[model samples]
Target: MDHGSSHDDEVLGKAFDLRLMRRLVRFLVPYRGLFSVCVLLILVLTGIQSGLPYISKIAIDRFLTLPWAIVTVESAPGSGAPIPLGDDRYLVEISSLSPELRKEWEISGVLSPTRYLFVEEDSDKEGIALEHPDLFAPIAGGYIASESALRSLSPSETLSLRSGAIAGLIRLSILFAIALIVRFVFGVSQVYLLQLTGQKVMYDMRREIFGHVLRLPLSYFDRAPVGRLVTRVTNDVAAINEMFTSMLVNLFRDAFLIFAVMGIMFHLEWRVALVILALFPLIVIAAFEFRRRARAAYREVRRQIARLNAYLQESISGMRIVQLFVQEVKANERFAKINIDKYKASMRQLLTFAVFRPLMSFLSSFAVAIVIWYGGLNVLRGSLSLGALTAFIQYVRMLFEPILELSQGYNILQGAMAAAERIFILLDEPEEDRGGGEAIEEVEGRIEFRNVWFAYNDEEWILKDVSFTVEPGERVAIVGPTGSGKTTIIRLLLRMYPLQKGEILLDGVPIERLDLGFLRSRMAVVLQDVFLFSGDIMDNIRLRAEIPEEEAIEAARFANADFVEDLPDGYRTEVKERGVTLSVGERQLLSFARAVAFKPEILVLDEATASIDSQTESLIQRSLTKIMEDRTSIVIAHRLSTIREADKIIVLHKGKVVEEGTHTELLARGGLYAALHRLQFAELGGGTDPAPPSPSFSEG
Candidate 1:
């Protein structure tokens, strides 16, 4: 009931429709191994990425936090000896010393000899002496001090401490480097594997959709515009490809990343992780809204693009008519209107993305601010280490990246869903019925239309009670004015459309009961308008059939297509789109050659030579007679002169058979056929006679 372009009316569907997703997943079934590899790589990559921040935390807490100072130690009297504490430091036991001696040691900046600590002092007084200066002396260069004492290290001790600190820093740096390299490797591998899997899946989907389009009923195409179908097969399929190659795998990757970051944050500090989690609902809301608007916008974009394409295809195809009628300005105006519609749709999609991306970024930044504020307080309160707080900040930032990416991926998913809906709709269309009847390897060319009535649309009959029969090997010419159901009869015989009220028999077997391919293979029909694909002449003749090159050439010769040999490439001569480089007569000859190559048992010509000039018509007529010989031929012609040699003639007018007989007998009857003949002859500047001799008349 809608009357809008079918492409425009295509439903957008839900972004995550389960039924549609299930259908999409079926495409990945054959590539499960690749998909498995990509999943494994994503998991590994996420793990490595999550661990890097923890490694930084370790460097901050362990090695970097160690104190930087030098200590002085004294051997306890004679019984006390210095004990090694490893790494160029020593300890002494002073518990055995007398209290007076301990007091003396304490006054001299020394603890019990066993546990001496470093103390800081003025560099200018490095050599200054005191009453107990001899008692407290730095071990490496000057005096000994207590464990609790603060002393500046002598030059030698300073060098040793600096060297140790540098070594620890180097070790941490090496660990960081290792983590960085490992993460890089896994990241690259993950991306490559995921993209490869997506590409392969896309390839499979495109192939399957194209194959399905080829098998749809011809009647479906009769109503569907070429441009809309092209969009379905090409542009719509590409949108789905973008989803596969970018969105689908990235969806999993981003989810893994977000969860991994959350887990790490919680492990470091649950309270800080909760701060980030509190923002998740907001992000989810934004994502949902983005998906909704984006899906609608993208659907509009697709619809507009379909409209633009259809207009362009129509305009370019009918350019000659437009120019001849001086409608160039009007045509341009129409094109500009369609083009602007598409442009507006595209900009809407752009604006949606532009707004959503930054909005996501803003949410992510707000979450990060929350983490920094809360986590910073915990670090300052001494409840959380500075390193842990820093890691939390990093994790929070990483968390939002995936959220933002998830939002963008959702955008891709929405577009892909719209595309998938259209594609699946096409795939769901019923294929042409191949029929369950017995197959026929061969058939006598006998055709009969028994009281057949048909309409392309609801009771608006194109043919009413049309009945006729042609025996085996009989040449029957159907003469009619335009729209008299002559061509419709030919279409019905070829089973291009279903019969509504009658049966068509081929060789005494109803065509509805014949194998579609076998039935079609037995007959060849050439239309008044010739269509040629962009290929060499030989390919056009052979089509999908495996006719040998020599045999194709022989068929061409039989059809009097000798002009092909005169072309630069001979049989290999390139035919541009629609065979534009060839003359009208040449295209007709090629069609004849195609029919001849197929070697059909029945031939149907629907005014095949109606458009050619007088000279070209003569050439085609000679080849037509050759191809029709010994073959049961049914010719629909406006030019009565062309059908004069037929064994029988059936005259049609207003969807009914007005008369039937051979040419002379039909002329003698002075019915529709005679009137048409007289009109055609008079147009050629000849006078009509009641009884004329058998003269060679040129066809219009």
Candidate 2:
């Protein structure tokens, strides 16, 4: 098929790989005792389950022998009928034989349904063919009192070989009880074990996947979709749970039961059992072929489901954007196309299942029919007993159960395997590149990006040999047109992605040498889009920072966010979904305050005031200058007025530094920077000097 279909098959194929399955079994290694106990219990239960029908046959044979001449072969004088042996009747009997007829009977056999009960002594005295017959008299009497009285004949007067028949009813009742109890105990135990294992394993799987996802590089997430990853962590792992909990266990139990029952059948009569087993190869071949097709179909189904889940998630998350752009109809049509594809995949899988299950059922039924035909004739020819024939029928039916269970198990395994492939692919992704350098003991906040080249993909370079430097405790504004790789510089400097050609340095040390966590801890960034957690104002501001409450309020005041005091609950005030409860200006101010509360050595702002009104913008600028004092700062400025007082302004055009100087120096240069200034801020008609701009600084 196509690449996507092939990928699905690869995933589904993982379930059947002996090596992979063995590794997966390692998860149960800690609970080996429980697993061993469970396996032993299942085997015991399966054997017991299979043997019950044979026991029923013994009971039936005993009952049949109770009221007939167990042996009669000699002709009577006048009636021309066979003479019953011994003085007693109603017991299984042996008879004297003619030379020729007896030889034939000895060599082959003659068995019929005619009732012929004779009596014989328990000459062997082993007492296997006899019992006292008094112990169960009361029980038998309740059912047939007259028959019981006759059956309890005294040994001194006359004893019968069929004495075992007297307790036939009791024997059958005991066997049934034991069988039912075994079944009940095994069923309950299996459920408890399966559920317990499933729940524990599922919890661990989710935790592991989520933990790995968290440690992955941010660039990995930039390329991956949110919903697809969610599908793996949720739906894919859930599929594995379903298989492990139920399907895999049942497959083992059923297969074991079927084989054990077959062994017993062969023990009784290998010739007849072989005839019954002759049909198995055909069944297996058919099942294997069908399973292959079903697996392919189911893998397609899983792929469709993932695509659909991703589509649905994206559609809902961006519903407002879709509506604003009037693309609802287009989105709906796209959804419909994917939904139809999913439906088709499911139907194809269903079709495969529909064919496979019934085919297996039919093959099993045919095997049973063959057994009945041959087994019934064997009974007629005296090669088999009626009870044995009944047992064979039971055994034949039992064989089908495993086949059926295997079919279902294969279905689940195939689906799970497909899901697992996708999940494993994610888990196999390479982690962030921590360059082989010793960790930095400390950082001084002096920063430089020297001849760095980078790209998100191999197709085009987003940044090309771009270089810049900022002195310690200096504020620099990075101004550029949209898509000119302004954000990329910060990303590279932070080592979210490795630089292609050159290195970024901090405090005279290559950033690669620094501990990633320590580097991030010393730096703070507030993006154009403010992300507020689902908590009160104070919690969001602290955000695992653990700042003192008093310091938090002071920082808020510095970011012009003291508006919390005018609200009903100050810093404790709740922010609803994504901080919708707060105005955009308020959210931006809080983000700034959060940054200040961290007391970072360096601060970075990406058009943090881009969306706020000019009035709020003016208030934030005053707070911004106060926060920038004595700190190394990088401001990606969209509003020219906001960065007028920066110590240095670096104008970027298409990933290259086109100009660098104070605002006035850039205006005097009359280059690309001058053109951008005229286009962006000239309409304001502001003077060159804005309250004595911050003194410009340079790279050492």
Candidate 3:
């Protein structure tokens, strides 16, 4: 394994990749209806949030602030713009004038510099207005008094005269409260719907990735770590979920808020809106720098995290070996080194956020200051209402708020892009060659390997020019010394790995032409080490097939796995991971039972009884003759005595076939097989009883 491939898998992804996003979006297609509703809710929620500040502006300008201004209109224009009071005094709403119109009136010396409040002629306030007759000007149904003159009256008297303004303020207050409540309700709905959509999309992506992984050729697993593939299905897929929920949803919401805030600001006061809008370039520059640095920091953090997770998985899986070898200290040091690297990378990411957020904060404040400085001058000159100025300040803050969220959204996108790249790379690996192959219902199981050459890596051949044939219904045994490519023959026969040269044929049909799924269904392999899943004995025997319980029991009986009947649960006995609770001989029995349940035309045994005790060997020997009866069987044995009754035995030395004959014939020839037989029998004190071999063979 080129360890650099780990880093290569960790592609430093862009903050936004259009192609990757399009692929990610494919997951959402299934839930598009709900996704579209969520987007619509975001728009509706943004309008409500944006309107909240405008509600405050309405409360301030129309009801709270001084609401009347005296205008000298030269005896009232034909448009009836102002309500005439008397002697050139006309009352006009101060909040109604545009900045341009207000400037025209001020230049003509018609707009009043002082603010005023109107007193409607009602029983309570009329008497109070009468008391301030000197400052209050009589109108058609009320009196208008300058704000400065109202201060001269007693506090109780002023409050009495301004009761109408208080009433109007109460109504606007009620409206503002209602808007806030509506915003809260819709905000909650929007968030819930968005998160639910995100979860569904993640579910689809994970299922697809897992199914694709199962179809991948076994050779791919030889190059990729189990932990790496697990991370792709679990951690990497989850990161994409975060991106969908956090970044994609918020991208719409924050953009809508920013645009709505700007529109409201311009509607309230354009000059102040322009002042804040000008600062956006500065905001853009700061945010660009933040996103750039944050992407790099975030990429490094993700890479380190993946590395740490891979290391931790390996350590936990091999912890038993580490303790047995007293390498605990060394393992801890290696883990600490990786963990510290992760911590340092995390700190760099934190530092990036620490610096950028404050910088964005400074920009937000700078925009506020500009609004205050420029809009305040207009307020003083009587061209801009104080209500609009205050609203402008609120809108400026709202504008930068979206920019801040976008910075964080960009950060999520960076991680998501990298994760997505690794995931898609795995998905893009062509699924094993299951297509374009001929399908067959059955085969005679006359398997042949013709001029086969193979290697795990480049040019390191495990089998060189190997050719052998097992005729239909013939029991052929392959015997060899350790590391002599015995197991490789069985694996190649099953097409576990592709051959570099020559072809494998089943019933004279090239194995490659047969559909992979159909071809594998014809053979059953039982190895020395049996792997069991976390399930009951029945499931292990049938292997999740449609085989009935009766079939499983019959198969177990045929394989002489009778110990299962003695167990407390019998065929229903629960198997632990890898059947660690079962004895070695019992696991081998289960393997045989499972093979029988599959009902294959061919049986391949690779030292299936190589690690059994003498009593268990006698127990299994009785089943072997019955189980392999009338079947085309190919067996690899290290114990020479086990294959003595075999119809024919082929002996391999190194990567080549050295001798081929019956066991007695090979012994008479006194070749490599004969030497090995003599050596083994000598170790057993010349006894004919075949004991289990000391060495187990697996071609690497």
Ranked candidates (lDDT, high to low): 3, 1, 2
**Alpha-carbon lDDT of model 1:** 0.75
User: Candidate 1 residues 1-700, lDDT tens each?
Assistant: 2213554435666667778878988988988898788788778777777888887786665444433222244432433444444454445433344445444444454432133332225443343322246435545433445423323445554444335446876887898798788878877887787778777877787888889888888788888776667777777777777887778777877888888888878776678788788888998899889878887887788678767666776778889999999999998988788788889999999999899888987887787788788988765543455577778878877887777777677656777887888788889999998775666657888899999999999999989999889998899998777778887888888888998998999888889889888888899889877889888888999997578988999999999998998899998888887788888888999999999999999999987867766667667888988999999999876545558889999988889888999988988898887887776676555443221322312131
Clashing residue pairs for model 3: none
TM-score of each: 0.82, 0.83, 0.92
**In terms of TM-score, how similar is model 2 to the real structure?**
0.83
Best by lDDT: 3
Residue 31 local lDDT, model 2: 66
What TM-score would you give candidate 1 relative to the actual structure?
A: 0.82
Stretches off by above 4 angstroms in model 2 are 1-15, 64-107, 110-166, 433-443, 565-570, 686-700
Looking at candidate 2, what is the lDDT of residue 516? 80
| lDDT (Cα atoms) of all candidates against the true structure | 0.75, 0.72, 0.81
TM-score, predicted candidate 3 vs. hidden true structure: 0.92
The 10-residue segment with the lowest total lDDT in model 2: 691-700
What's the residue-level lDDT of 524 in candidate 3? Answer: 89
Error of 2 at 474 (Å): 0.8
Please give the lDDT score at residue 119 for candidate 1: 27
lDDT of candidate model 3 versus the reference: 0.81
